[model samples]
Target: MERGLTGRYEVTRTAEEAVRAFVPNPLPPEPPLDLSGERQRLLEQALLACGRLDGVSALLPDPDLFLYAYVRREAVLSSQIEGTQSSLSDLLLFELDEAPGVPFDDVVEVSNYVAALEHGMNRLREGFPISNRLLREMHEKLLARGRGVDKLPGEFRQTQNWIGGTRPGNAHYVPPPPADLADCMASLERFIHSDPKPFPDLINAALTHVQFETIHPFLDGNGRVGRLLIALMLHDAKVLRQPLLYLSLYFKQHRAEYYRLLDRVRQEGDWEAWLEFFLEGVTQTAGGAVETAHRLLALFQEDRNRLQDLGRSAANTLRIFNALCSRPIATIRDLEATTGVSYPTASKAIETLSELGIVRELTGRQRDRVYAYDRYLALLNEGTEPL
Candidate 1:
């Protein structure tokens, strides 16, 4: 299925020199994707994994408790792919306004990702269509703070942009010129809202992801925005009850291969190869999420069982413990406000959990100590090691 140079390139003049910027052909690549045999098997496996992930949502006693931490984990991993060194703990620490040694720019970028994602999910839940407008809104939140604040947050690039090079003249891949960006994105919008989609939702997501990367819509944060689109698309199509199937970990694991496949789709019309890779990512990531959910559930139960052994203090400790399950990292004041316990009770409960090794103090200060649910954070920290 070599469609020979997937899109036409036009020579454009950059301030440095003349460069050939590529304008990609609209969605539904020509000679349609070959979905027979192995591809079909992969698709089925991905769908089955998704079904299991959807089932996981219903099984959790409080899915939001899991989502609260899981989404932050995703935020860390996703921003890590974009060269941010912000770890999950850095984000949690930043959220509490106690960021000391953490990189402010990196943590702020990651925090913005969390906010952007929350905004997108909320809008989707409010029955908003996944269109260019929503993408802009999410993009606005994404670059609203820190380093990317100057990158034209919510708007498409009005100037040429390139990827991986010193300048546009020597860039690895130059996206379409500014003049063509609007039309390119509009075409993408139509495909998103197409009445009879040419491909199934998952397949469409894979296709849309590649197209978004190719288009390179925004001046900055294109990579993060494109990845966010995948979760939004899956949730919109009802593939998952929650926005849980994040491919950042998988993509981060297979970084080179992921980029190579995206290039192959444009260089050679090898949609099947990319589709296979995307499906594997879907299945692997979804399955990993389900396993994480189960582990969290078991850990919750095991810790709750331990709380029962607290004797007379178990009743009050349980309230604080439940609150920690959602926040994982909290100040005594936060614990008091959330659990509605007095400051003394909150302090005593956290001290008890610290003795039990269920929670550990993040800051050594005796006055404004912050506690971390150590085991819980460790579970979510898996595979999020900085690159």
Candidate 2:
């Protein structure tokens, strides 16, 4: 077993003790209710907007703003948990492969975090069980690039880590010692695999998230990995098809209250209050994501129509435009491969877009120039940073 920071304490807690320790205090007294009429109407509006996003012929509003915000939020949340500092601007440039002065390793970590999230979501879509094996796979991906970290990649921690402080010596909360970790993890695995007491999916998510945090299973990447598990569980429960909902913003916004709620759950068994908080987060975050998706779809449609109006080569233009949605930055080489056009033809199509003010040259150099879907990126970045 690994030692604590002072080397004076060893981790030890039974799985049952661990669960009892982290459960919210003052368990909520009431069950979660269906959305009220007004809230239901709002959800319907959000769904309608999302539907427009899915429809091929629907007009799209500026979606890049929302995309940018979502991407930034993910970066910030994932990085914060791992103690990596990155700004929205830094994340934006990193995503574009234009970030300067940032270490390549840091960029790789961020990318891997995003990829893990996407992978988990895709697996959920295929209806795979959120097994311990799956969690290990994700953990492995998270730590695959670290140089010398002793915490085994893709495995539960055999050591102890603390939360809410710079060092374990000074941490506000010291989780169960390492000796107890195995039992704690086993109990969690049981919860995931078997139905326990009846609970709403949202409540189950909150309980699972809290328990994972308490377990702090991995020596590193526990916070990010735990949060990712929340999204995975939500999808597995059929709450959403995409890993689009994020609670980071809510937690970030209510940082103190978030922790307090968790503490209260453990101290008072207040599962009811915690469940309410979680459901509100769900309803709010989902509503916002739906809005963003609609906005993005609208922007895409408008751009498509603009290209159509230009009377550009219909097939070539559509191909290039759709490619930009997936890849905001592109080179002539990229276009040629994506469109199956000769280099010269690809260059011509790019020139046509440039002439029509649809694409902008991101790199001023004439040779091996890079073009950007500036508006699209901008839309994706919106509300991602503090105003």
Tell me which residue pairs clash in candidate 1. Answer: none
Clashes of each: 0, 43
**lDDT, candidate 1, 160-226, per-residue tens:** 9999889999888999999999999999999988989888899999999999999998999999999
- Model 2 is weakest, by summed lDDT over 10 consecutive residues, at 1-10
Stretches of candidate 2 off by over 4 Å are 1-77, 80-101, 122-128, 147-149, 312-315
Per-candidate TM-scores read 0.99, 0.76
Cα deviation of 134, candidate 2, in Å: 2.0
Q: What are the per-residue Cα lDDT tens digits for candidate 2 across 254-311?
A: 7688788766655554555565666667666666666666666777788888778655
In terms of lDDT, model 1 sits at: 0.92
Superposed Cα RMSD, model 1: 0.9
